[model samples]
Target: MAANWMRRTFVAAACASAALLTACGSSSVDSAISPDRFVVFGDGLADQGQLGTSFTVNDGSVNNWTSQLAARYDVKLTPASKGGWNYAYGNARISQSPDAAGNASTPTVVKQIDTFLAANKFADNDMVVISAGVSDVIANTMAFINGTITQDQLMANATQAGADLAAQVTRVINAGAKHVVVTGTFDLGRTPWAKQIDKEQLLTQVMLALNNRLKIDINPLGGKQVLYIDAAYQVNLFQGNPGAYGFQNSDTAICTSVDAGAGIGTGNNRVNSALCTPNTLLPNADPIRYVFSDNVYLTPEANRRLGEYARDIIVLQW
Candidate 1:
């Protein structure tokens, strides 16, 4: 009877150990890997000062959409961006050279990717966001703006830009990122810079074409794994009615200098200083007008829109 009792006790202990191990295994399998790190690559819209200086004069604040997204999601961000970068620049960095200029003749997105990858290792749960192609449109359309480039070149460059963006997306996925979010281009024509070119419609078409190509590229990857965030739609929502989205007063045109009155707009108002002349009139000593800083960058409201879009893409529920 003593021997039988001892054997029964041992059997019970073994069963308990097996059950505990099984429980642990199940828990590990069920828990989703938390993404602690994020890598962002793009143009001035997504740039967090990668260019070392603001492309627009009088722009003092150096916050971009990616920075806001990082703050909202509580994730560490590695920003690799320059003003005026494009997709071809990103691909060139991945392939041969590490230097390529996009539409604005600035460093390409590829260089930023290379810089990020060289410095850090991407884990399975890591996320990478690619926001590019706008620079391509700007650069390709430069001739049109200056009366030196033809429409055909603009179309061809736009097509190339789409291909470049697609290639960059594929490269990011191939690098072992668990998830990659490809964002569509924003409406560039709405910006104050559009006034200089007078080709807002053409630029919009180029951006849309690039976005469609990106969709085609992403289709091969299973929907659950690779995701594409429709930033164009989200941004448009704000453009259609900035006041409805808490940006009605964030206009930057009213402020003449970098440190002028309360700053332009509230949060959703358009930063239109079209009537303001440069270097001639100022309520204050500063003569900057209509831009985040000077007369070319995005206003605080536009930055907020990008930030909101970033939040949607990075955060699971926000």
Candidate 2:
């Protein structure tokens, strides 16, 4: 009887306030409130200068695919805003904190989420875009390949990344977000730095394995509200045929400043996207036509293309 009263009260209040019909005839439905905002999270690939200067800025990422995606929903990404009610940051990882040894002061993906929710809540209409876990995969795989860590240890790290993703999703749901789209990292082993080593194929397998584990953990939680984009598939499509995307090289660094040591022999070189200004390399270098601006990060055009793919993914989910 008390449940019925609460339902009636909710109905009356909703109708009286010009709210959309939200009650679904059961208490199990937490919130039917849709949001008008686009909340984003994750690493440099999806970042828009929230952590500092961004990788894609030189190629005009501010006006690129990210803006186009938001335009679909009639909202543009705004970083450094409270509630992440917009784009978040660069260098975000699932298993590593922003303060970890080599992060350059960026926040962990989990902590970013926490910071956002500490000031706000979500609604059904709110769309969230997230792509992460590459850093974790890189860290784990490098350790194993270098014989500093075992394959078993790498596997454990992969599992932890999946768990962290699950936790992130749960937190979003609890915060009332309805449409949460999480993407896996692309095949990191195919990057310029990884391709130089004989272990590239093994690294690809490890990266894909981590993505598979993430897929396993997240797919069960899908509904009309949650989504996941197979990032490895998307990125491999580009690498498989660079000409299709107007790029001539996916295997060489476009920027002279690209650290040859990134995620490779030393594994201590952090990407300095800010150093990758347009035309900073050859006087005539076109940052827009390359796949990578640095060793492990995407060129602005690549990021733009990836954003376009992300938009398509979001459309299919709808």
Clash pairs detected, candidate 2: 33-124, 34-124, 34-125, 35-125, 35-126, 98-106
**Residue 248 error, candidate 1, Å:** 3.3
- Residues 117-148 of candidate 2 have per-residue lDDT tens digits of 78777766678876677666766766677788
Model 1 misses residue 167 by how many Å? Answer: 1.0
Best candidate, TM-score-wise? 2
Which 10-residue span in candidate 2 carries the lowest summed lDDT?
Answer: 18-27
Task: State TM-scores per candidate.
Answer: 0.64, 0.78
Report, for every candidate in turn, its global Cα lDDT versus the true structure.
0.50, 0.62
Off by over 4 Å in 1: 1-33, 53-62, 78-106, 249-296, 313-318
Count residue pairs with overlapping backbones in model 2: 6
For candidate 1, the TM-score is 0.64
